[model samples]
Target chain A: MTGYLVAIATLVGIRALLALGLNVQWGFTGLVNLGVVAFFGVGAYTAGLLAVAGVALPAAWAAAIVASALAGALLATVALRLREDYLAIVTLGFGEVLRLFLLNEAWLTRGANGITGIPRPLRSWFPAHYDLFYLGLVLGCVALIYLALERLRRSPFGRALRAIREDETVATVAGKNIVRFKVQAFVIGAAVAGLAGILFGHYLAYIEPNMFVPQETLFVWLALILGGSGNNRGAILGAVVLLGLLEGSRFAKDVIPFLTGVRLAAAQQMLVGLLLVVLMIKRPEGLLPERAP
Target chain B: MAEPLLAVRDVVKRFGGVEALAGCSLDVAAGSITGLIGPNGAGKTTLFNVVSGLTAPEAGRIALGGARIDGRPGHAIARLGLARTFQIPRPLARMTVLENLLVYAPDQAGERLRGLVSRPKTIARQEASIRARANEILRFMELAPLASDPAGTLSGGQKKLLELARALMGDPRIILLDEPGAGVNPTLMRSLVARIRELHARGVTFLLIEHDMDLVTELCDPVIVLAEGRRLVEGPFAEVRRDPRVLEAYLGVPA
Candidate 1:
């Protein structure tokens, strides 16, 4: 039971990191990045490939971050010219294209077989309680990221992003380089997502293109909207609640017995949809609305 | 005279088949409050948009301080010491009045991500000084009481004041104010006029697009009138207002 709880907590921490990244892009900057999973997959694949090639874990993680940041910058440079809805469509398409690339490039990504035996950091030190140690590491990362993001939220950089989000024309006339700020925000968010991916891929000791479907992006969005879009604490809370809803539904099969695995997955999605509907009606600002500073 | 602060020569901008700005040319002398008055669709706002880099002109030359700025982006034009306000005030609604002003402070080290990390001390000091200046501007604009309140909570006139205050924060060499008197109550209008005069006295140049003839006559020096996307006449408000062409443009009567 302890191990199960620790695993759930670890997953929650990982998801929280992703949600935080999304919050920076969507919440603070008002960028509609529907291809979040592209950066996630990039990070996972980069780290996984590097690890499999016998690179140091830190170096591999760093490479993953740089790779994802560059990918984000490239996408923003190309697609930010298209505003709002077009941007959403383009990013969504970008994610699918990256996923297809990963699937077809068997030479690099090992095709559909995926990478396995990705080494965990400090595994030798906590062989007996490796899960607990990993949980500690994940939580540490979450805390660090949360604090950093909060500092950013209160900084001039964050203020400019919020201004751009509210009114781009106003921000532009006030001397903000709209494209520059947007690209920087994207790069930072993608780098954070990449870090989360490195942790996740290493935690599972395996990663595949299948792990980063468009549905995964939806889950992070749900978590962000559930917790509160702009509030960092709300983002973390949303991830915890979202993971709870998903993982708790596993026990529903035992209670209802008629729910098979496929049906159970369907039920979980419906549960999310229903909860979102209720959330939208009850507290559209989210579970923890952004507080005015 | 001594090289105008802003010079637009024969700029042309088209929207679909319609020409919004057809060979419009004007000059704003340094340290002067220049008024641009025109009838509906006379392209006063469009001309402002083109000069401020919000819209690109197909044919024209624009120079700010004698440097060509016709094709530059809006933010780049802004950074080159030009700032503008929208016709309908576009305040950063979700932010506080103070924050709205703070966001307009140019060249803050804290505005960069790397500066936040590499020069924490410099960022902190710069932020403190910027905050102090923003507060001073807010007080000058009589918005000190609403400093912490969201800009969206303000009345229409207050938003206008906030908009002007935000533009002032950038300390631009010249400001393009789009209809400063529109939608403002008379009491607020008097205060707004007073502020503009005070700033003008401080050597800040202004090119205002206004429908309020009284405000223009009281505040403007050399007024430029537009008729059908081209300059109708240019002179003092007394002379421009009396021009047969200006009357024809405003009343749609043959000059």
Candidate 2:
């Protein structure tokens, strides 16, 4: 039971990182980035491939961050030119395209067979208690990211981003470079998501293209919305609650033996959808709504 | 004669089938409150859009301080010391009233990611100074009491005051205010007029579009009248108001 709890906690920390990234893009900058899973897959693949090739873990992580940030910058340049709603469609398409690339590229991603034997960080040091150490590592990372983001949220750069989100024309006339700020925010958010991917790939010791489906992106969005979109603490809390709901629902199979496999997955998705509807209607700002600064 | 602070020459802009600005030309002298008046569709707003870089002119030259600024992006033009307010007040609605003004402070090093991360102390110091300046501007606009309130919560007249306050935060060389008095209450209108005059006296140049004849007469010298997307007359308000062409543009050929 303790092991199961630790595993769930670790996953919550990982998902929190993703929620924070999306908060920067969607919550703070008003960018609708529906392709978050693409960046996640890029990070996982880049780090997993490099680690399998005997590269240092830190170097692999750095490379993953750079690669994902570049991808984000490229997407922002193309999609931000269109209106906000069109940006959503473009990013959603980009996510599917990336997943297809990962599935078909046999030479690189092993053609959907997935990559295995990816080494874990500091595993040899805590072989008997690796899960606890990994939990600490992930939670430490979440804390660091939360601190950095909170500082940024209170800074002038963040203020400018919020202004751009509120009204692009007003921000432009205020001497803010709208394109530059949006691209930077996108890149920063993508890089953070990439780091989350790296941690997730290492924790699982394997990664498959299917793990980064569009549904995963939706899950992060649900987490962000459940916690509170614009607030960082809300994002972390949301991730914890979301992971709890997901894990707790697993016991439903035992309680009602008729629920199994694909049906269970479908039921989980329905639950998420229902929760979103409730949130939109009753508490659209989420559990921890952003306060005026 | 020195050169005009802002000079728009033979500018043309079109929106699909309609020509919004057709070979329009004008100049705003330094430290002058220049008025741009026209009927509903004479393209006064379009000209402001073109000059402020919100809309690019199809053919023309616009210069500020003798430097061509026709093709530059809006933010770049703004950073070059030109600021403008919208026809309808556009407050950064979610941000606090003070934040709306703080975001407009020029040369904020903390606005960049590198500056933000690398020099925390410097950024904090700069932020404090900017906040002080923002507070002062808020007080001047009589919006100090609402500094912490979300700008969206402000009344329409208050939002207009916030708009002018935001533009003032940037220490702009030239400000293009589109209808500064349109929706403001008369009490607010008087204060707005006094504020514009005060700012102008401090060497700030203003090019304002206003429908209130009394306001324009009291504030503007060298008012420019537009008719059918072109300049019809330019002179003092007293003289320009008496121009037959100006009257024809407003009232439609004396019919």
Candidate 3:
């Protein structure tokens, strides 16, 4: 039971980190980035490949973050000028393209077979309580990220982003380089998402193109909106609750023997969909709405 | 006199088949409140857009403080001490009145990432001064009581006042006011006029677009008239008001 709880907690921590990144893009900066999975895949593949090549964990993590940040900067440079709907389409296309590249690049990503035996740092050191240690590490990182993001949201840089989000023309006339700030937000958010991917790849100990789907991006968005859009703390909490709903439904099959795994999975998805629809209709600002700066 | 602070020369802008700005030219004298007036579709806002770098004119130059600024971006022009307010008053709506004011404070050291984390004391000191200045501006605009209120909650006239207050935060040398008195109540309009007069007295130049003839006649020194995207006349408001061309521009001649 403790091991199962720890696994759920670890997944929640990872999702929280990803949702925080999306919050910075969609909530604070008003950038509609629908290609978060692209950055996630970049981080996971780069770090996992480096690990397979015998690189140290810290260096692999650093390289992965840089790769994802560069990818984000490139995307922003090309598509930040496109307004909301067009940007969404462009980013959605980017995620699929990156996944296709990962799937086709057998030389690096090992194609459909994927990369296995991706070592987790200190896994041998804590064999008896590995899940607990991993959960602690993931939660620790989530807390640190939360603090850093809160400080950023209260700082002038964050204020400038919010200004651009609320009124680009006003921000421009007030001497804010809207494009520069948008790119900055995108890079930072992507870097954070990359960090999450590094943790996620190690936690799974294997990665493939199938794991980094557009559906993963949708899950993070659902968590962010369910929790609250602008509040970082809300983002973290949202992840825990939404993931609880997802993983908890699996246990329902155990209690009711008549329900098969496939039937339960479909039922769980429908419930989550219904919840999202209700949330959008009733509280579009989210559970924790963005506060006045 | 002293090289007009803002000079727009023969600026032309077209949208598809329609020419929005047809070779419009005008000069705003330094340290004076100049008025720009025109009938609807006369390209008054388009001229503002051209001068402010929101729209690039297809033909001609805009020089601010005697340096060509036509092709630059809006933020670049803003950094060169030119600021403008929108006709609809775009405030950072989710922010408080004070935060809205502080966002426009020019070149804060705290705005940079490294400066925010590494130079904590310096950022705090700079932020303190910016807060002080923003509060001071709020007080000047009679909005001190609403400093903590979200900007979007303010009434339309109050939003306009907040807009004007925010423009002052950037230490701009010249401010372009778009329809400042258009939707304001009489008492607030008087206060707006008084504030403009006070700022002008302190050597802040203004170029205002106003439809209120009373405001143009009472506050403007020289008025520039645009009729069908062309300059109709230029002189004191009273003289231009008497011009037959200006009269025909506003009230079309009987067919």
Candidate 4:
């Protein structure tokens, strides 16, 4: 039970990191990125493939960050000319295309069989103390990212992003390089998502194309919005609450034997959907509204 | 005997079937508060748009300080020492009044991503100066009391003042104000006018677009009038008010 609890905490930490990435893009800069999972998948695949090929974990991690950021920059340049809703559609399509590519590319990604036996760092040093060690490591990463984002939130750079989010024309007249800033923001968020992906892939010791579906991106968005879009702590809080609700539903199956498998899964999803609707109707700004700078 | 600080030459802008700016040209002399006036559809704002790089012209050349800026982006034009304010006053609504001003400070070290982390001392020093400068500007505009308030919470006139203060933060050599007096109250309007006069006296050039003829007459010398997307008359407000063409443009017949 203790091991299981630690594993759940680790999952929550990973989700928190994902939520933070979305918070930076959708919350801070108001860039509606629907292809967040695509960046995550790129990072996971890049790191996984490199690790499989005898590359060191540190080197693979760095490469994964670069690859995902490049992907984000490419997407921004190609689709950012289309504003708002149109941009959302383009990004959504990009995620679908990326997942399909990964699914079909048997030679590189092993098709749907998925990559297994992915190495975990420091797993051998503390064999009995593995889960706690990993939990501590993941929490440390989260702390670093949280601190960095908090610093950025209070900086002049963050103010400019909010300024751009409010009115691009006004930001332009005030001498902000809108395109440059937008691309930079997209890349930064993508890099963070990539780091989260690396952590998730190593922890799972396996990664499949199916793991990065649009539904996964939707969950991250839900977490960020539920916590509070612009507030970093809200992003983390939303992830914890969301994960608790999701994992807590496992007991529903034990309590009611009839609610099993697909039925139980469908019920959980419906609950989440209903929660989103209620939140949108009552507290659209989320539980912790964005703080004014 | 001196070159105009800003010049727009024969700019043409068409929207589908309607021409908003057709062969419009004007020049603003350095250190002068030039007024721009026109009827509802005389293309005053359109010309400002073309000059400020908000809207690309079909045919025209816009120059600021002898350098062509029409084809450049809005921020590029701003960096070249040209700044503008929207008639509707689009403040960074979520930010505090001080943040709104600080956000527009050109080329701040902290604005760079690396600079934010790499040079903390330099960023802190720069931020201190910006905060000090913002507070001074707030006091000068009589907005000191509301400096900590969200810009969205300010009254309409205060928003206008904040908008002007934002442009001033850019330290632009030339400013294009689109109807600064339109929605402001009388007392606020008087203070706004005084602020403009003070800025003008300090050698900041202004090209103002206004429907308030009273303001034009009082503060403007060398007022430029646009009628049907073309320069109709250009002279002192006193002389332009008497021109048959100007009167015909405004009143639909010679006065």
Candidate 5:
């Protein structure tokens, strides 16, 4: 029972990292990146493929980051030209395309049969402490990413990104290369997503094309908006809280009478959507609004 | 005596089939306050937009600092020391006045991905001076009191001031103002005119688009009149005020 709780905690921690990446893009830069799952999947697959092929965990992790960043850069090269809603559509399409590619590409990812036997980091050395070791790893990653995000939000470049979000014209007249700043932000966000993916892949020790679902991307976005879109801490908090609500609510059908499992699941999602609407209507700033002067 | 800071040579703009600027040409000399005066829809703003890289001309060459700048983006033109203000001030509502200034200031060291991972100290070092300078500019614009406020919260006049401050963040030689006095109150408009004159005295150049003839005459050394999207004539404000085309465009009379 304790192990199961720790596993869930690990999931929450990893999802929180993904939420922070989306927050930086959508909240600070006004960039609508709807394809976050693709980057995460890229990192996961990169890490998973390498780990299963006898590579060291650290090296596999390094490959995961490189793969994700490269994917982000490539996506930015093509999709950065889109504006607002168009950007959202293109990103969503790009994620779909990547998912389909993963689904069909058998030579590299073993197609839909999925890849397994992913070696956990330090598993041999800490055999009895596997769950705790992995928990520490995820927590360590979350801490590092959180610190980086906080510094980024306070930096000059981050401020420029927010300014670009407010008004691109103003930024442009002020001598900001609006396009360049945008691409940088998008790529960085994607890289963060990829990092989250690497963590998730190792935790699962299993990889399949379906793991990079569009629903997962939407959930990360929801977590970000829920946590306070522009704020890094808020994003992570939102992810854990929202994912908890989603998973925790499942236990209700077992305890309560007359409620079916499927009904409870549907109810959970509806409640999440309702919470989003209510938040947007009332505060619009999320639980943790952006820190402003 | 010096060559023009901004030269729009025989520019022509067509919207579908309607000719907006028909073979228009104008020269803004270095370190002078020049006014572009015309009635509503006279193509003054369009010409300004085209020159500042918001709109590309169908047939025209724009030269700034003795180099062509017709086909560049607005930011590119801005990087070339040409700044502009929209008729409606477009300050990013979400950012503070200081953040707005920092956004446009050239960032060579902080624009890269590696800057985040490896060059933290360099960015930190660069930002202190940039923030200090931004503070000084905000103070000069009488905006120090509200430097920390969200730019959207400012009054019409202050946002205009914020826009001007944003332009100056760059070392711009020429500024194209699209009706700086349009939404501002009378007193702030006077302050705006004063600021323009003061900046002019400091050797910055301007191509002001103004409907307020009084403000134009007070600050502009030479006023260029436009009608139906083309330059009609250019002369001293007093002379241009008395020009038939100028009067006709304003009052619809042959005064």
Candidate 6:
């Protein structure tokens, strides 16, 4: 039970970080970045690849962030020049390409059999602990990232990003480089997802190419939209709540034998999709509307 | 005193075979308040679009500070010291008034990723300067009390003021005001006109579009009229007001 709880906590924490990034990009900038998983996957793979190669934990995590950011910058440079609909198509394709590369690139990524034995952070520094130690490491990082996001949410740059989202033409007339600002927002968002990916890798001690699926990207968007597109606090809470409903439904299947295995997975995804649709219908703004500061 | 800061040379533009502008040209004298006047469908707004690069001319050229900028993007033209206000105010509805100004304020430190990380203090200082400057501009437009308020919360007249203040943030050499008095109350209109006059007095060149003939007569020195996107005449307001073509365009000919 303790291990299960840790797993849930770690998953929610990482997902919260991803949701926050979406809130900034889609919620604030009106950019529909359909390929968020690409960056998150890159970060996880970068960390995983580095850690298994005998790199230190901190350095691996740092490399993951930088690598993810660089990838995000490249993606932004290409994607931002296209119209919004075309951008969506290109990004979706880009994500599939990233997955295919991870699956086939045996030399670097070990292909389908993901790298395992990711070293736990702060393991050597503090020995013989479980809840306190693991929670302190994972949740603490989550908390720190959340606080930083809040700080940025209230900053001038964040405001400009929202402005561009609301009306690109007016922002341009206001002397804002609309494309430049949006690309910056996209890059920053990807970098955050990368950080989350690295955290996830260390927690699992295992990484697989198939693990970073498009479904995970959709889940992050679900959390962002469900919590409240414009609200960061809601984003964190949404991630937790969505995960609870998803994993909790699994325990329900144990009570009912018919809903087992593949059927359960389909049901889980369908429920989320329906929930997203219902949420949009009920309160398109979000579960928690971001209050004007 | 000085050569006109901006010169339009035989500008021609069209929209789907509708000659929105037909060989129209005008000179905006340096630091002087110039007015563009015409009735509805007279291509007054179209001429504004040509100058702002929202619509490029099919022929002719635009010069700012003696350099051609005929086909540049609106933002590029803005960065080149030519700023304009729209007929409709487009304030980033979600952001506060102060934030709207910061996006346009001079960023000597630049907005590089390193500047965000390494020169944090520099960014903060630049932000502070913009806030102070935005407040000053807002106060000048009698909008200081609403500086912290969301720009969308302001009244119609106030939004126009925001539009003007937004242009002022760039510290441009020339500003084109499109229908500054439209939909605003008389009291607010007077205030807006006063602000424009004040900015003009401070050497901000203006090419104003106004339906309020009284305000135009009061504020404008030399008025340029556009009818079907072609220049009709350029002279004193009263002369243009009495010009037979101007009267014929506005009131129509004998039955």
Question: Best candidate per lDDT, number?
Answer: 2
lDDT per residue as tens, model 3, A1-293: 98899989998999999999999998899998899888888898899999989999999999999999999998888887766466678889999998888899898779888899999889889979988889999999999999998989999899998888898888888899888889889888999899899999999999989998998999999999999998998799889999999998888998998889999988987998999999999998888888864
- Note each model's CA RMSD in angstroms: 1.3, 1.3, 1.3, 1.4, 1.8, 3.0
List chain A TM-scores, every candidate, in order.
Answer: 0.98, 0.97, 0.96, 0.97, 0.96, 0.95
Candidate 2: clashing pairs of residues: none
- Per-residue lDDT of model 4, residues B13-130, tens digit only: 9999899988888899999999999888999988888888887999988888899988788888888888888899898888899888988888888879989878999999989998
After TM-score superposition, the amount by which residue B188's alpha carbon in candidate 2 deviates from its true location, in angstroms, is 1.1
Which CAPRI level is candidate 4?
high
CA-lDDT, candidates in order: 0.91, 0.92, 0.90, 0.89, 0.84, 0.82
Ranking by lDDT: 2, 1, 3, 4, 5, 6
Kindly give the stretch of ten consecutive residues in candidate 5 chain B with the minimal lDDT sum.
Answer: B104-113
Worst ten-residue run, lDDT, model 4 chain A?
A: A78-87
TM of each candidate vs. truth: 0.98, 0.98, 0.98, 0.97, 0.96, 0.89
Residue runs of model 6 more than 4 Å from their true location after superposition: A119-127, A130-132, A254-266, B12-19, B39-43, B53-59, B108-112, B247-255
Candidate 2 local lDDT, A1-293, one digit each (tens): 99999999999999999999999998899999898898988999999999999999999999998999999999988887776677788889999999899899889889688999999998889869899999999999999999999888888988998998899999989988998899899999999999999999999999999999998899899999999988999999999999899899988988988999789889998998899999999999999998765
Q: Please state the error at residue A271 of candidate 4 in Å.
A: 1.1
Q: For model 1, how does the per-residue alpha-carbon lDDT over A182-222 read when each residue is reduced to its tens digit? A: 98998889998988888899999988788889998999999
TM-score of chain B of each: 0.98, 0.98, 0.97, 0.97, 0.95, 0.94
Pairs of residues at least 3 apart in sequence or in different chains that clash in candidate 3: none
> Each model's fnat?
0.90, 0.92, 0.80, 0.85, 0.75, 0.48
Return the TM-score for candidate 1, rounded to 2 decimals.
Answer: 0.98
Model 2 sits at an interface RMSD, in angstroms, of 0.7
Q: What are the runs in model 2 whose C-alpha is more than 4 Å off?
A: A82-86
- Model 4, global lDDT: 0.89
Compared with the real two-chain complex, what DockQ does model 3 have? 0.82
